[model samples]
Target: MDALHAWAWRPDGPAPAMADGPLSGFVLGVKDVIDVAGMPTRCGSPLTAPDPAAADAPAVARLRAAGAVIAGKTRCTEWALNDPAPTISPFDADRTPGGSSAGSAVAVATGGCTATLDTQTAGDVVRPAAYNGVVGLKPTAGWATTAGGRAVAPSIDTLGVLARHVRDAAAVAAAIADGPALFAPPGRAAAPRIGVLRDPFTDRVGDAVRACLARAVRAFSAAGADVHDVSTGVDLAAVHAAHRVITFAECASLHRRRYRDHAERYGPRARELIERGLGTPARDLQEAGAVRRDAAERLGSLLEGLDALLVPAVPEPAPPRATTGDSRLQIPWTLCGLPSLALPAGTAGPLPLGVQLVAARNAEPELIAAAAWCERVLGS
Candidate 1:
């Protein structure tokens, strides 16, 4: 089968034999920022000309050891920031399949590979998965090591998985974390209590997205889930602004020099962010960190008794290719560092809308369980 052309680099010969393990039959794609031994970790930039990685990144090695075939390096936004990749959405060629995890999402959506490794410092993973109508899970921060992936807001960046099924996403996550293969256990005692966040963030979503989310909630409720409208009381705009400051500051720290010397080589969006980072004060970043902590605590409190938070993954269906789509709906959750899983809820126009189920930190199993139930409900 022909793998999606989302690859930035591919192996010359046949991939190493799929070693015997839980992931033996799976073919996986690695995002460009992730090191895959002999492949170059390009980070989708012309400026940061890097050499081939000497060894696979820890996460990649873990999957390789688990018997997943290395498909190739997928495209990403420049430096995993605002820049867009060349990938067009399989559902609608005129629109973008969000980034910087665009290629990975496209790969899975088009059946190019079983799954792909993706990273999210902001909304990279979820937005792309939503645009492509696939499953994307961003595990709790630090669950998967970032040992060899190109750095992008180290404090918030998280390695995740993109697949067509929630179970496939969970399996890859478990393999990478070296945890139990809890893809989706059968028959939990009762239905999950899912919280639906009704805040300014979700309010910003268009009618189409809201309709889609409403349908998913109805499906969950019908399937015995106890769905409630909840609030974290955290200001959405403030969280998004703080995330910007933190992201820019950390990103600047990692690429300031290269950015200074190779300004022309960087994309316009990348250059704009690097400049913003360079100009940002230490006080701003520290303040943003405080906000992040408070937001995380507030979010945790909101999920206190609920199994997960059901919300719109993106504010609207995939927009025109001029931009990668908004991350407003996803930014707050990302900053909170909660485990979030995005799954296709329904269609909005010709494009698809996704609903995200978020649980407290390290509660991936709970997230998967609820997502599995919702997936079945939507299918029915």
Candidate 2:
């Protein structure tokens, strides 16, 4: 009945009110993709066999060590793909909250928890946070360990952070990073050089979203950021195709046995994706990897003199709840394995809008710094 309160776990006992620690007193919602001891990881699908994990995921273990409460497993799209979860957004009942990390975003946005762990293969983390008016941080592909989490694509599936504030996101990130120095506060730094990405992706956005982004750029300029347009110069269509091939092929491989035996249990969308993956030739996957490498190089060149790249977190505000919303905006960065931070910029009509900041691999600190700056100046 409680959409925000998806479930609860007290693995070590009730969350304590510890006075000191990176995440002391923080209640975190873990996406169903991540394993939490004593909880059955349903992964937002009735098809999941609901296995109780033997141990906490590495990220979960790190957070628990840092004094964060293992709040519960949040809902996700079935197997972290096109299948929709049963959760609804607190902002508007009619519109989708975004997925496959929908419940995690909704929990943070609604204040049901202080923060939440999300996962992104495409826009699962960034798009949903944008739609729900929260901050979502997808660190570099391998920054946080995914040992005990369900995988969509082993190569790209990343554990991410979603919260109401950039600082909260950073704190959780640091805890999970297993490296305390990744998010050390950047003190009184000069304005960062920001790159604005535009193309067919920008063209697909609606008027309100365009205005929201324009205003955000203006705000950054007023705050002394060096902003400019930068082109990735890669064939985006091919890049997207590459991403799909990697994700679908890997997903099918991971579930090949289960899907073969219990095909009827899968939702329609999951079935479609898996079936496509099953039919894909190995040569296509190899070619997709080549495309991914090429795009990564081009993307690196685009960021040569920039601190971060700016883009709409999604094409528009949250759409009707029937769908999870478009993922086109966040796919490029995800494919490139760059760290991206999505911060609520403003609103378009009744729903929230977000802008994303992307940085090079292991450049999470820069991403966090720019996001914090935007949060302070833009007042989201």
Candidate 3:
């Protein structure tokens, strides 16, 4: 059963060739959260009764224009949240590949596709890519067009790019970015100043993840990147609460009418969240928004002096295939609306692991450039 082939992946008319366009030779997988004209987007949930997309999503259309061969929809966590998808890891079917963009990351990691379109409301992009050992790029909010994609947590839903190599990740980002970015080829004669996030790596977080991150930072420094320590002074608890409110409220509003009318069709997690969201008053949402804006400003200030902030993309590598990895590390960054790139630097024993490079607001070009720099510094 060619379980991994591109199903419902071809664009309108004939297959698009990148030679005819910018992404001519590249093959891409689109996460089911976004619309792709002819596909039946199940989104790995038994509950979603989604209709066929009437038109290509704006993002999908952009990729098609670039001459990319649209591979089939990648698997995702149920409703882009906690529920695990049926998609198994290519490296070890018994282990999870991560989620909600599980399929997208695994596809690229397994070489099922060259690149993929992943959407992250929280750790969906960064976490999965880290577990699968692939690069995932989450640009600043609104930087990548979101028209035609299903709304999970609208306020925080971020469009991300997943690829096997940093160069491929950068190229796809350039094609989808606001404009052409300044690309400095990797392997610079001088080292780059990089910051290492030690809070999560010490006695505070998962040991395997921290060990892998330490090794990765050492590799970068050895290759000429000045890895250091930097801190974002914002209250993480406040940021986390703010993230929850916005995500739940937006989700509740998106399918308010239907979710209430046909409760049986939805999963336990989705239904529970909707209930929690419905309970959240408008005032709370407003407060969440205010805090989010403030958090972004503080993060901007935290990252002001550094070229990039280094952190583990996920708490640990892929857990059991049944449970998607924990998302504690990724939520704050997404809440701040900054540019983040996850590098598939090395592994944590059996499962794959990655490091995140975060830039200031609207600093995607630098994020990618720095990512390219790190890619070379780490030597694959």
Please report, as a residue range, the 10-residue window in candidate 2 with the lowest summed lDDT: 3-12
Residue 355's lDDT in candidate 3: 82
What ordering of candidates by lDDT runs from best to worst? 1, 2, 3
Per-residue error (Å), model 1, residue 122: 0.4
Candidate 3 accuracy as lDDT: 0.76
What C-alpha root-mean-square deviation, in Å, does candidate 2 show against the real structure?
Answer: 1.8
lDDT of 1 by residue, 227-306 (tens): 88988788878999999999988898898888778889888898898899989998898999899899899888878688
- Candidate 1 C-alpha error for residue 283, in Å: 1.8
TM-score, every prediction: 0.96, 0.95, 0.91
Where does the lowest 10-residue lDDT sum fall in candidate 3?
A: 1-10
Off by over 4 Å in 3: 4-19, 46-51, 182-190, 200-203
lDDT tens readout by residue for model 3, 1-380: 14642232344476544556677788988988788888767666665665677777877887777777787787777778777776777767787877788878778877888899878888888888888778888888878777777778877888888888877766676666666463222344355567776553222567886777788777877777777887666777788889999999888888799887887877677788889988999899999999999988888987777778887777666788768877767888898888888887777666777888888887765676678878776766
lDDT of each: 0.85, 0.84, 0.76
For candidate 3, the per-residue lDDT at 119 reads 87
- Clash number for model 1? 0
lDDT at residue 14 of model 2 (Cα atoms) = 67
Model 3 root-mean-square deviation: 2.7
